[model samples]
Target: MKPQVILFDLDDTLTESKQKVSDEMAQVFSRLLENNKAAIVSGAKFEQQLNQFINFLPKDSNLKNFFSFPQNATECMTFDGKIWAKEYSFSLSNEEITEITNALNKVLEETKIIENEISYGERIENRGAQITFSALGQEAPVSAKKTWDPDQIKRRDLQKRLEEIIPQYEIVIGGMTSIDITKKGINKTKAVNWLSEKLDLPVSSMLYIGDSLFPGGNDAIVIQTGIPVMETKNPKQTTGIIDSFLKENVV
Candidate 1:
């Protein structure tokens, strides 16, 4: 049976990290919404989603059929034509945010990996319910970000240290050069389950596509939910995956 909804990871999977979605992907996305519901789940904040993908969607695309899971699924937004409204959002208290910040500082100080690295924009951002540590800065060029941690060795070590220091929070490697810290149990799987319940579809009727499904990758959590998954290397391959899906199932 065809999937009731298609869930996608934004960075790497749908487009280059922090890059706008291609015109080709936009057309394919609009076509996708013609027959099925679709959702974008990313570690990015809502504005990133807006600039990178949502803004490029076809004008006539059915807005109601789309969902946005930003901030590592800590927040969910749905389009209501005029604007995107919060379906739900989880927030951290001031004290919790402070603790997370302090923990990150302690980890960085102890690890000393990122301390000497040159950064781009803001490195640590508190996105309401989640705090992100973008190693090279959020606006760093994709080339720089890719080179920063190709083997994932650097980030995996960072994540391990973070987990030890901030055991209360869920920490995961995100995007190319970022670490996501969210409240416990809040990850990509949370978004997938929420969509399953809201759309009244079983996990078996859903498919998740992402670039990072390997162990410890941000998108890896969805694997625990028993949803079908496809791994794509980049946006070009993602377009091909969508095209094939449309051919096989859109009729």
Candidate 2:
């Protein structure tokens, strides 16, 4: 079915695999904004995600053009402050945060995760309420990342163990050997669901495009609700999807 509203995944999708959102994607975003039906539903936090694409946007434009549906916080509008079009954020307790941090650090420190020169970023990001345990330390090479965790079994196991230590928190595998820990009842799928209901739309009427849609992958949970899914690969493909969606539907 054609969707009424379309959601986006920033990283490997609109941006290249390297997570760089190019000028081409920026133009596509401007087009989507003109249509007023595009939103970014990504794993990155609002502040961090906005930092990536905000420069490409016009200075006078409102920040609501993009949406950052992080696992821990309610969806944050790109330019808008914390409370945006809607609120579905979940904050972690101090004790829960400390406990998970210690456990994740211990596991990553003890194991040798794949690291490649193409890799960029960090091994750990305590995004305030959420903690990301990255095997590649956020700097593993692209080629190495593709082979780092093909089966996802290892990461899944890590999630299970982490959950055991802090059952109250939400644990899920994410981008290239990274595990995102959030407060209970928080997940990408949940964030989308919350947004859909608040916007008075149906689940089936939305499509989420993300690179992490594979099983045990961070965005996999959204597939459970039967929302349309798109595998994020090239930025051009994301542009094509958005253009196609616009051509097929009026909004």
Candidate 3:
């Protein structure tokens, strides 16, 4: 049976990291939204979500069925016909932010991963609800991000270190080279539960698509909700999955 709603991870799953959605993927996604509720949950900030995914959709697409759960679902935005409105947002306190940044810096220093000469843009970004540490820097090229941690070994090591330092926060590997830190319970599982109540649907009625569903990956948290999931290697695989859903006329 087709899922009543589809949940997706933004980067890598729907589009290449930090890149805009392709025209082909946009068309298919628009069609998916025509009859099914869909949501994007990512560790990225809301602006990155818009620039990379939402802005590429066709004008006539069903915005009402679209939802944005940025910052690893620490924040949620829903379309209200006229505009996207924030449904709820969880923010880190000043002290929490300071501690997280300081811990990240300590980890970087201990790991000796910071290469100032090759790094691009900000290495640490405070997204209000979440803090992210991008090993290759936020503005690193897509190719660089991909090669930086293909096996996720390097990131797993960093994640382990961060966890040891800030056990109070939620820390997980995100995107190609980013590690996302959120409030203790503010992870993708929260998004799944929120949608289940908001849509008045059972968890089994939803299907989640993501690239990072493996152990220690950010998307792994959703597994606790018991939502069915499809794992993809990249955007191309995600497009194919969407195509199959459309072909099957699965809403």
Say which candidate scores most in TM-score.
1
**Candidate 3, residue 76: lDDT:** 93
Candidate 1 lDDT (Cα, 0 to 1): 0.89
Q: List per-prediction Cα lDDT, in the order shown.
A: 0.89, 0.68, 0.89
Looking at model 1, which ten-residue stretch has the lowest summed lDDT? 242-251
The CA lDDT at 177 in model 3 is: 84
Q: What is the lDDT of residue 194 in candidate 1?
A: 99
Query: For candidate 2, what is the TM-score?
Result: 0.82
Instruction: Show model 1 residue runs off by greater than 4 Å.
Output: 249-251
Q: Which regions in candidate 2 have their CA more than 4 angstroms from the true location? A: 58-65, 71-75, 78-88, 109-122, 139-144, 249-251
Kindly report the root-mean-square deviation of model 2 from the true structure over all alpha carbons: 3.6
- Give the C-alpha miss distance for residue 157 in model 3, angstroms: 2.6
lDDT of 1 by residue, 1-251 (tens): 56889999998889887889999999999999888899999999999899999989888999788999999899999988788799898898999999999988887888798877888998999899899998988778888887899888988888888788889898888887888898988888888999989988899999999998887677888998999999998899999998888998734
Give the lDDT of residue 63 in candidate 3.
89
- Higher-ranked by lDDT: 2 or 3: 3
Clashing pairs in 3: none
Task: Report the Cα lDDT for residue 243, model 2.
Answer: 76
Better of 1 and 3 by TM-score: 1
Which residue pairs overlap in candidate 1's backbone?
A: none
